[model samples]
Target: MKIDELHQVFLNYPRVCTDTRKIKPGDLFFALKGDNFNGNEYADQALEKGAAYAIIDEEKHTGKQKILVENVLKTLQNLGTFHRRSSKAKVIGLTGSNGKTTTKELINSVLSKKYRTIATSGNLNNHIGVPLTLLSIKEDTEIAIVEMGANHQKEIEFLCSIAEPDFGYITNFGKAHLEGFGGVEGVIKGKSELYDFLIANEKGVFMNADDPIQKEKLKDYINKYGFSTSDTKYYQIRLVEANPFVVISVEDTIMGSQLIGEYNFTNCCAAVIMGKYFNVHLDKIKAGLEEYVPSNNRSQIIEKNGLKIVLDAYNANPTSMYAAIQNFTKIEGGTKVLFLGDMFELGESAHEEHQKIADLAKELDFDNVFLIGQNFYEVKSGFKKMKSFDDLKNHLTKYSLPNSTFLIKGSRGMALERILELI
Candidate 1:
């Protein structure tokens, strides 16, 4: 479809949904095709459900509002680009091996206090998700915080081309998605595409200056910020109080946070630095950071039936796992128990990476450790280990109780959060 045609459709009807499940009355539904499902088959069903109109490729099916398109997914992308030109919102694109989602959430939470903000929901940071998210932006949105994620080379570049971010933030570089990205260097090349995009566009980049790789690649950019030796603007974690709240002071000028640990402090820094760059006031930025809460299971402290639980089991890579373990170690003196599951998709380096995690467990001297999943056998060998989640139950039931802290974490594949039931 032509750009003019898309803009006309967008101006006439502001919202779009590709999934029939989420379609609301009066919303336009784009019947997009997928590997295992043919959305065109469900076009009538979507219209019947509540969709004001259905865009389908089939010629036989026709209605008053139904429009025919050669391809629905491509049309959605084209329509999103047309909508992008109408809004004056500064787009900040964030992508990294770890912490991109959390950073996006934090940045959105912070920016919302000062502007009419639109953010990517959940892990909708891919090809179809990006366009769908952009199309959701209302006409009055002042800032759009888009999280760009990928498992292979140039996936980020493709998304960047669509969003054309005015600014960029890379949380950190680490070993993740080894199957598609090949290895750590491949991850660097893939993620740095955003940095390259920002440089090419003469925009700005925010990164962790402490990372040598980030510092090197972003040095030439005129507009850049980081937390490292080279960074004039840096965030430092001064103290960790633990429990009721974590005290974290950033960059000397800003006071400490209620959120726990230095890692979270750094995450807050990324949001504050980027939000401030967008002309958001310091007080507004502080309010936004303070209002932010943990999404999914990324480090939320909860109490159920009088039992304290630290739920860190959303998704885990080596970098995030290591950070969680370090945070566990600093909890004053408690009967610290760690319920760990397998880390997935590490490719050829799985053994070494698993063993390295085991070494961290031993170094931290966790009071007790339970390893779940077959891949965690190597992790079991590194510490006082249990064979599986059931074995962990047997041990815990037979053992005595203590007022100690417990840390549960693993990749999504292992579903380690299930362990909380037995705790």
Candidate 2:
């Protein structure tokens, strides 16, 4: 069927679901395939679970109340693009190595304060998720923030084609998904795909003027924001403190926020600058920044058992890990301890990057540092090293520090947040 026809079906159904178990009545289910499972196999189950219609790719699954497509994923993407074209909302296509979700949420919060806004939910910012986020926007939505995540080259380019955003931003490229992108050079090339799209379409980019890399790469058609308004081309902003939580000054306004990590200062700044650029009132933008809080173990400060824990274990790469460490060391109170795990998907650079973090810990002279994961264990550091969470758990059973502040961070696979139970 044509995209227009599919979009009409989507208009009537209104809701979209990819998971069979989560299908609701009157929802459109798209059978998406992946490495481990084929959603096509569950198309019938989704329909049986009250889906208004099942869009399937396999001919064998096509039947009553089911629509067959040449390719379900592509068709769903087309439908999403069609829906986006039908709406008058301004869309910003956001992608980066880190801070994609946080930045997106901040932008959504700031925009929603004055306008009907929709954003990519959680970490749903991929092939299937991006399309779904676009399709989820209502006709009344004044703005939509489409978060895009890519582990390899050309992925962002492909996603941009689907979302077709009017504007774009990259939240600083760093060492992430190295195994997939080849190396640091590959990371720059991959994330810059957003720039390619915006430049090609004659769209504007919200550039971080303080970031030399972004400055050098995006030298044209920019919506700029960063420290130092002395330049006039940039919006002035400053990092207050993220030891307890992120605080920032957007020009004359000092917005105190609940987000932690000085690294997050830029994320909040992006929202404020973008809000102002889009004509959101300064007061409403500040309200949005002040009201927002970080969750899902991404820079959360938990006070328990007389110990303050800075938990940022959502995901870690070389760039983000160092930023967290620098922020923690700057806080000169209580016994400072470190609980860092492996940085995954670095390919051959994994050992070197993990060692680099270990070296940073030793150089910074934290009271005591604990390293987990095989890659970290291989590093020859004086900091306490453990092979796994089980090993860390066993050591924690015999030792405990109650008064010190702990900084816990690692890749998602490390599940470093679990250490909170023992610490």
Candidate 3:
């Protein structure tokens, strides 16, 4: 189909789905192909499930708007680019090995207080997700926070071509998706695609001055909202302690939030910088960060059965595990218990990454450590071996966990959160 014709459908109504499972009324479903299943096979099912149109490559599908395309995925990408160019919104693309989602949410939270904002929702920050996010933009969207994630060298470059961010932020480079990215250097190369793109496009870059590696990569971009690098174009953050909230000092103004940890403080700093550059008032920026709470299991504080649970177990990599450990150490607690689980998708570096986390746990001086998953086996063998996951569950049942703060962390594959249900 011609670009103009696709625009007539896409511009009028968004290209919304590929799966019939989640199709909503009036949504345009694209019959995309995958290894196991052909979306064309489900075209009729999508229409029956409330999709207004089913876009397919197969000629057999019949419906009101079941138009055929040579390739659905590429077609969606093209349509997304068209929609992105049609909008008046400024886009800020964010990508990194770790903390991309959290940072995207933080930036969106701060930016939304002053402008009509739309951000990448959930884990929708990949090739398919990026296009979906772009097409979701509406006329009122003054700003779009696009989160891009990649595990291969050229993935970020491909994503950037479609995203074409006006400004950008690379949260941090860490050990993640090592299978596809190769190693730390490959990780850097994959992530730096964003920086390279920003430089090529001549866009402003916001970076974490605290991270030496990230700072070095974007050395040419004028730094914004960081401390210690005051001469390097930065924003200062001084944490104020009080009851259940933290006071953040930006310049002369002190802003407060219920969030804890130096990592969150840094996350807030990035948001403040993004907001300031857009001319958002300091007070509004404060409200935005303060009102915004961390989502899912990342840095969430929960109270269950008289025990304070720090459930940072939504997903884990070496970088996030370290952050959670550091954050846990800073809090005043009864007895600190570490329920560390496996960090998955490290590929060849799995052993080394797992051991590094074990070393970190020992350095933190935890009262006890509950290691889970096969990856933790080597760590347990080297460090003080804990009883298995089965034994730990039994221990929790027989004995009351002391008023100690419990830290549950691991990659998504480990399902470490299951301990909560058993407890």
Candidate 4:
């Protein structure tokens, strides 16, 4: 069936499902295929589970309730684009190397105070996830915040065409996805695709004026709003301190947050600026920021058995890892211990980046540092290094460091959060 016809069917059964196990009655199911599994094989199961329609690309799966399409993925994308164009909600497309998920959540929390808002759920900011998020927007949604993540060139640009955002924001380009994007320069060019879209379409953008690269790249864009510490022309906010929790002063009001790390200052500032732009009351914005607590091993502070722990193992790269360590240095207390794991996706530069982190850890004033993973183990460092989690687990089980402040961080694959169980 054509897109318009499918859209008509969607208007009746608006709920879209990808998994047969989660199929609800009167829901439209899309049979998405991957290398390991073909979703077409489950079309019959979806129909049995009461799916209104099962969209599939395979001709063999065609039936009374099964609709055959040239490509199921493209059909889903086109349908999402079609629905977005028809939506009354103002779309805000967000992309970046680091803090995209956290920034997106912050913006959503602040904006939802006044407007009927919907945002990308969790870290569902990829190709399939973007379309799914757009499809989830309802008619009553006044604002939609879509987080876009890219590991290679033109991924953001392609997602932009689907989301068709009226406003855009890039968190900051960092040494992330180095293997997919060639290097730091490639990271910049890849992320700036959002800027390219907003500029060409004459859309508004929210930016960090404190960043020199952001200012230089957006010099020619006319429609832009910024937040900074010193620039009075835009919204001004200052960081009071980040001892364990972040405290900030904005609009003559002091706000305390549950989030730790000075690097999160920019993330919080961006949310405040977004709230102001939408004319949300300063009190409501403060409430939103204050109520939010970091989760999913991202900058979470936990006190257990007299030991204060900073769990930041959700993701890591050279940029974020450095900032986490630098923030750890400022916290005043007992013996500061760091359990740094290998950062992934660095490609050929993995060894150098791991060595740099090892060297930096040596120079810092930490009482103990333990490096985990193969990359860090290969690096020539004096600190206690482990090639795997079992090695670190065995050592930590024997050695007990009481009343110490622990900073545990690494990439997602490393699963450094497991250290909490050992401790």
Each candidate's number of clashing pairs is: 2, 1, 2, 0
How much does candidate 1 score in TM-score?
Answer: 0.91
Please, what are the lDDT tens digits per residue for candidate 1 over residues 220-303?
Answer: 666776654344566443443444344544445444454555567667778777766677777777677777888587787766
Model 4, span 1-423: residue lDDT tens: 899899889989999999888999998999999988888999999999999999999998788898999999999999999999889999999998889988888889899999999999899898888988999889999999999999999999999999999999999999999999999999999999999999999999999998988999888877999999998877899999998788999978998888888999999998999899999999999998998877899999888889999999999999999999999998776999999999999999999999999888888968999999999999988889999999999999889899999999999999999998886
lDDT of 1 at 320: 82
Between prediction 3 and prediction 4, the one with superior TM-score is 4
Candidate 4 or 1, higher TM-score: 4
Worst 10 residues of 3 by lDDT: 223-232
Rate residue 156 of model 1 by lDDT. 96
lDDT of each: 0.77, 0.88, 0.80, 0.92
TM-score for each of the candidates = 0.91, 0.97, 0.92, 0.98
Which candidate should be chosen as best, given TM-score against the real structure? 4
Q: How good is model 3 by TM-score?
A: 0.92
Clashing pairs in 3: 225-235, 226-235
On residues 1-423, what C-alpha lDDT tens digit does candidate 2 reach at each position?
Answer: 888988888899999999998999899988899899998899889988999999999988779999999998899888889999999998899998889989999999898888999999899999989999999899799899999999999999999999999988889889999999999899999999998998888877887877778888866554434433345667778776665677787767888888877778778878987898789998899999988888899988888889988899999999999999988987655899899989999999998999899999999889989999999999989888999999999999999696899999999999999998896
